[model samples]
Target chain A: MLEEAGLAPNVERKMRLDRLQRQPEVVGEILKEHVERQQQTEGLTLRKLSPGVKAMIWFLRLYVVFMTVVVVVNVVQTVHP
Target chain B: MAVQDVGRENAARALDRTRVDNARKNRKKIWLLWLLIGPGILVMLGENDAPSMLSYSATGSQFGIGFFLPFVLLTFAMAYIAQEITVRLGAVSKTGHAELIYRRFGRFWGNFAMLDLLFTNLLTLVTEFVGVVAGAGYFGIPAGWAVFGAIVLIGVSYTFRRYWTWERVVMILSLSNLVFIPIAIMAHPSWGAIGHSLITFGPLPGGWNSNTIIIMLSDIGATITPWMLFFQQGAVSDKGLSIKDLTHGRIDTALGAFLAAVAAMACIIATAPLYIHHMNASQFGTAQFAQALVPYVGHVGGALFALGILEAGLVAATAIATSSAYAYGEVRRQAHSLNRNFKEAKSFYAVLFAALVVTGGIVAIPHFPLEYVVLIVNVIAVLTMPPAIGFLLLLINDKEVVGEYRNTWFLNVLGIGVGVFVSLAGLLYAMTIIFPNWQL
Candidate 1:
């Protein structure tokens, strides 16, 4: 299957950029959004969401919970039946 | 190694040369961007796994070439909508979904999410191996030999230690999924009926029956699942995709969805003969399916169908195993890029191979309740998808992570729409299972 997927060359040169990643200026451009997120969400909580977003989240959560129960019950029936 | 190093490295080279080389450098970077196409295509096609093909097979055998012919197309559209966000998220945030959840949602919810992924991934992995074994059996191969052969093939790619090579290799193999199209044509299905089915709702035998809904959920599960989100996000991040690659990533994903959807519909159309002739194939394994289809599609078509199943399993096992590895790397903060040699990222490769070995080995074991695993795998996948989609939307919309790249109003509407559709399918499926004899 691996043979069937095919291959490419020059990968070694292009595959990893570890050496240049050590430069702060380079790293910032690459991960600036990610780092900013880590700092902003340092103590993030559900309560921080706007009320409208919070309601939507809760509604989606309710559907998930209800489906979980239904699936468990279905699995039990299948195993028993 | 981080991907942005290329940008930094390219700049330094330009400074060494004359300032007039900026345009040439920019062109080179654009060419490099094209190399980032593997993950999006791999993950999207990889979603068309063994059990998913089986679900499509069942859909064809049950509903023939009617209602589901177009329904499957719509499901892929939904998959495109949901997966497009992951591409943008990975490009902008440069983090795996699990790690993002761990950092932003707290460990409590992250652990819950991880548990969901682990359970479903393992179950789904086993089904892929089941497909490998069953399809190989059609050629009179033993299950153990088939499983062992698959492990070797899937394992060989990881040893390459470069995501570019591995992704290209998977891409090449994934192309075999198209074999089903020819097989479908060999059956000589009426093109007029097929076109009419798409234009009209469906022939839809036994309209909205319990079995119909169950099959619908299975089709939904086949197209959209929790692992898809995790797998694509991890692949995008690992491939070192950047904001510049977002357009290509979306194109790659769209192309994959189109190919996979075509392959899936072909599987259904090929099996439609069984339904028309009343072959009673609801209990079929892959080998049984091929044997049953021999009369309709000819011996060659039948053989290709079996080959499609095997290919599906082989491709999916590698993709699914990698998803687990990516998740493990994110949550544990271990080295995870496919670009790393085993010595550099032992745990990541170990987890990936471990998942493959355990799942593949389980299928080889005698009397291991393989039927039970196959039965609930797709169903359970859909049932657990709501939370995955919920988390996906929340992560994509979070301003802190994606910054100015957060979802637009249209995307939010589409994302929520997919979540609701999946949830409804699961709910309807559960109703049918709980009240099996209801003549609704």
Candidate 2:
């Protein structure tokens, strides 16, 4: 996956593991899921996501939804009014 | 196990070959810099799109060569601060901005990022074509022919099927943005005043009003935008930058920033005559500005200004469309590199061409609020920028992602300063729009 992304594979391996260890707070939450998935032979891909990520993404969607609605109404009122 | 061993052997062999090639290439320092120059220069010049030039023109006509002369320069500096981080992030991750955000942050967040990019890219792409059509209109070119020619010209870059070739072609097209410098020179401004306004931030003929704030934010939007973050990072990854290329990356960004700043300032200086003549700000479009300038800078200079706007639109359309294509490919885990042939990256190329065609068509529609879109696009771009910056700072500071290449303390201060500036400006813009009578 790293090579396909055009990253030097060996260097990527070291970089990923190093980052995982240094940022332990996030490691268990994000990296460990990838590790276990890899161990299960699922192959390394972008499909995997943790619960925390899922929650954050939903929050963003809701936020954009609200902002879009407000901006649309405001623009219409201003333009057409 | 055998496959791992074979892969390692192949990689090692490739690495040795690369080292030899690098040694040979490094012998010509200037040539090496040229090769590393694409992404930064492209993003910076690309940001100087049609609406941006108009905003700069409006700045000149409204405020003259006063406060905005220096302010534009400062905004570009902030742009460099923000974009420099993208260079490091892309080089370190070997992944586009969307992919890295999705990988580290997850799918749901990726969806939001994708949405923001798609929404803004589409809007910005439309304005670019609007510029193209309007600028070409100056030469009596029909909108259909101009849009068609623009799509074709932009498509030529994609046909090269390699990032290097595409970068070189786009860089050549982008360099035409320099035409404004000659137009500025043609205007024959007071050199002392130009230097004085730049250093003193000059007086605001109409001081600190809502319109002033709007123009300031618009100018800021033109300089350091959200598309810039996505496009530059994607280009760096597409160009296959590694951490070792960091210095070249910084130089590429700084050089681009300087050129873009100069081009923006030139537009303002060239149009300062409109302010001196006291033309209404509402009356200044590409054609109007060019027509008004004929009496001042002569016919050739006005024609060149129109051509510069055309080039800006053409260059920015290509870059903005690619940003959308990059986001699409990254989120879906498809083949996304410019190195891939059409058949190999069908979805990638399709998305890119589709964006150009759709946006280009939209700009061709009569009385389609192209003016309204142009007016609102840059400001809205600034409005949607904070989240992009938030994601950027997170990824760049991701120790595992950029590793040792993450921003240092000084860089962090600068990056956050840019973020704060954008957020504050966005807030003020929002408040002004909402209230419509708030004093700044």
Candidate 3:
């Protein structure tokens, strides 16, 4: 099971697996979580963002762009002048 | 997933599994804690980047250790409030921040968040290299070799192709940020003044003005920023933190905040002598600050100060570059784990290294206005934060994503409070810029 789980052969790996071998239920649960995590390629599907949230996100996008320009202009003026 | 990817990831997880197993059996809580505490510490100290440290230096020099001292603490408190959410989100969903945004909000909005992260990250990364170059200059090292050495050092950190190995290496380097504390003590600051400032949070010295406001915004930016959100969440997920690890995660984050806040405060205190002695450090660069400190801190302390900046830049560059790669790989659905070898996570490693090389190379260009980027990067980080907080709040509240981990009302209040505070701070900064004569 340890080899199948891709744990490379080593004394440490052997010790850990041995310890886990004593607790079959714990090993099963850990392996189960590991496999589930590995198989999960995609996560939660698209959330239907509310209109208010959409508007806010848009506002933030523009806010960031606007602020970036402001900062660049400010810095350029300071540096060159 | 390819077999190699799975094997690499499983190999990383194998370590986590063993540690967690030991934790569950009540065997070694301290050992488990030591193992689990990476992302939080990294994210916090990683944020004590070159520019941020310089900003703290500026604060201490310009304002001395009074109002801004406590203000710095408040900002880290805000950082803690915001970063704690990422821990819960990552442990529960096991998804990177970008992946969650892309998966839930779809591409359009996700791309905006990506733009904020990548743009600021690139600019911030450049400033970090600037810090490296400047700090090395203090030691009479030329720019070319400094940039080359920094890139090589960062590259070697991940050559192990193990997340745990990479994290541990960076954590040790990150702790060097505390070099500021000794320098601070060496400066011989008034402990009474420091305690009074912490307790009363007053004597803002110059009072509220455009310069003070900008410095305030910069200090806040230094602590809380968009990349921190993405980086910590992505790191938490990549570290394979499960629901059971949530307690350790929060503790790790709080400890990180405490340490980072101390380093930041120490930086301010170390430089406060400049303000006290009425020296004009208003425009000192990273190297300049170190050089000027020699009179107060002596040559050795000055060297340590410069080394702190150097380490800050190196550690933050690694983390910010990795955060960029994590976002890129997650959005593209490519193999992104640090556990994977370069062959398995080619695009991931490519994005990471490309960001470093390009930004590092830019620092070598003649007359590149590198200081301007350093000056504005922290402010830009602050401006881009409100929306990031908005998205974080939404995602953390989404039942389908965090389920049982959904934030309670108390957490919501704190999260929303962080968003409002950041937004108001940004607005206040804009106000100062737009109406330059405005005063509080």
Candidate 4:
């Protein structure tokens, strides 16, 4: 679980165990919350985007390409002319 | 605890402890706000970069204080709309923008976004050094020393190895960007005319043409760009803001927008004297603008203007370099926190300083056509923003990511509106370039 949270397990285990001995319920609650947050961070997957969303993304991609060409042409004309 | 965990946890715990104490004691919210107001303010002022101030200066010198006063304000509003989403995304998901994009969109599309960001950021960073060099030239400082000084000053802030310390030190330096405000006051602009211009949005002296479209696009780019989204989200996540801090986060972003808008407008007002004198300053460089303003604003004000440009460039270079580092670290799954020491995050520091060194070196090359880079850097930023905004909107609306903190309907409308406006502005710029004779 500590590894999944991107934490060093060996280091975390000793510290968490020390805290658990002093405050069992509090430590358990903190551990549960931390694990949940870690799951949220790691569980993200590629979203199944809608068709309209997909088209919009494609349009924006092509728009960038078109603009890049325009900018290059503009630069060439201004610099050379 | 492990050393890495200790360093990260200690800084974050300091703030988290304060927050808990404030709630428990029923203390004033103002103290809590002061703690949460770094990223938003940093991103906003950082965007008021050297080229951006020069763009605003160009607006005033050419068009006087007419249409652009309000137009600049609107762009910040658009910036606010787009940036606010990042705050929520960071606070809720605790993931940086680059990582979120790669996770949800897959690496194929993510690389494209990264390419666009890095390309625009590199060009913009070069212009920043150009500003630093030009500003230093006003005081007869050599370009080599100026670039070296900027790199060292930026590097010094990182030595603290704490996000809060870096943010506070840079925030103090970024406030120097407001030096334009006093310079504007010294320019003695007509208050009545300024009021009338804001109300009417006109007397746009030359009317709409290719030059006007370029400036408008540049102005939009100045406020809202891809780097801002990445930087702010990374800062928020690294600062360890949670969903409970969302209200403070929004306040932080709004305050940033307000302060940046004021500085941007002050820049235009400070340079309007050139227009009043009928001086053609359309081709003036950063130092040239300062020198030309001396007759109207006097020697001290001119110095202030030059210093403002220098601060703008320096503050922005720090932020932009860190943003690139953040993005790189996020994608590589490496230690990326400012809270982490240099040894713990070697690649992060290397990327940050490497970007600064390379861009600064480019500006030091004699007669490298730095002006052209300054002129088009903002334009290129705007052109590349639509796709960045698209990805941003996608992630913000992804229920799996932001969960219950997803954008509201009204927020989505505003977000989409900003995207459409940016796209249309880019399209108009292309139209002007394609058909030089075209006029609006």
> Chain A TM-scores, one per candidate?
0.43, 0.40, 0.54, 0.55
Best first by lDDT, ranked: 3, 4, 1, 2
* Candidate 2 residue pairs in clash (backbone atoms < 3 Å): A19-B400
After the best TM-score superposition of candidate 2, give how far the Cα of residue B148 lies from its true spot, in angstroms.
0.9
lDDT of 1 by residue, B146-217 (tens): 999999999998777677678889989988988889988998998998999999969998798877887888
- After TM-score superposition, the amount by which residue A12's alpha carbon in candidate 1 deviates from its true location, in angstroms, is 11
| Pairs of residues at least 3 apart in sequence or in different chains that clash in candidate 3 | none
All candidates' TM-scores?
Answer: 0.87, 0.85, 0.94, 0.92
List, residue by residue over B1-440, the lDDT tens digit for candidate 3: 12222355655565676667656566677888998999999999999999999999999999998999999999999999999999998887777899989888888889889988999999999999999999999999999999999999999999988898899999999999999999999999999999999999978987999899889889998999899999998898888887778999999999999999999999999999999999988889999999999999999999999999999999999999999999999999898999788998999999999999999999999899787788888898999998899899998998887777888999899988988888788778878777777998
DockQ for candidate 4, please give it. 0.23
Chain B TM-score for candidate 4:
0.97
Q: Each predicted complex: what DockQ?
A: 0.18, 0.05, 0.30, 0.23
**How displaced is residue B346 in candidate 4, in Å?**
0.3
Winner on DockQ between 3 and 4 is 3
For candidate 3, lDDT tens digit of each residue in A39-77?
452545788878998898888778877777777666765
Better candidate number, 1 or 2, judged by lDDT: 1
Candidate 2 lDDT over B1-440, as tens digits, reads 11121122123222322332354355757756765678999999999999899899888888888899999999999999989998987766656788788877777677778878888889989999989888999999999999999998888778866677788899988999999999999999889999899788887886877788879888998997778988998898777565557799999999999999999999999999888888886656788888888998999998999999999999999999898888889888887767677887899999999999999999888889777788878877776776777778767876666667787888888887887788788667667667777886
N/CA/C clash count, model 3: 0
Error of model 3, residue B394, in angstroms: 0.4
Lowest lDDT 10-mer window, candidate 3 chain B? B1-10
Could you give the fnat of all candidates in order?
A: 0.22, 0.01, 0.28, 0.35
Residue B4, candidate 2: how far off, in angstroms?
10
**Pairs that clash in candidate 4:** none
TM-score (chain B) of candidate 3: 0.98
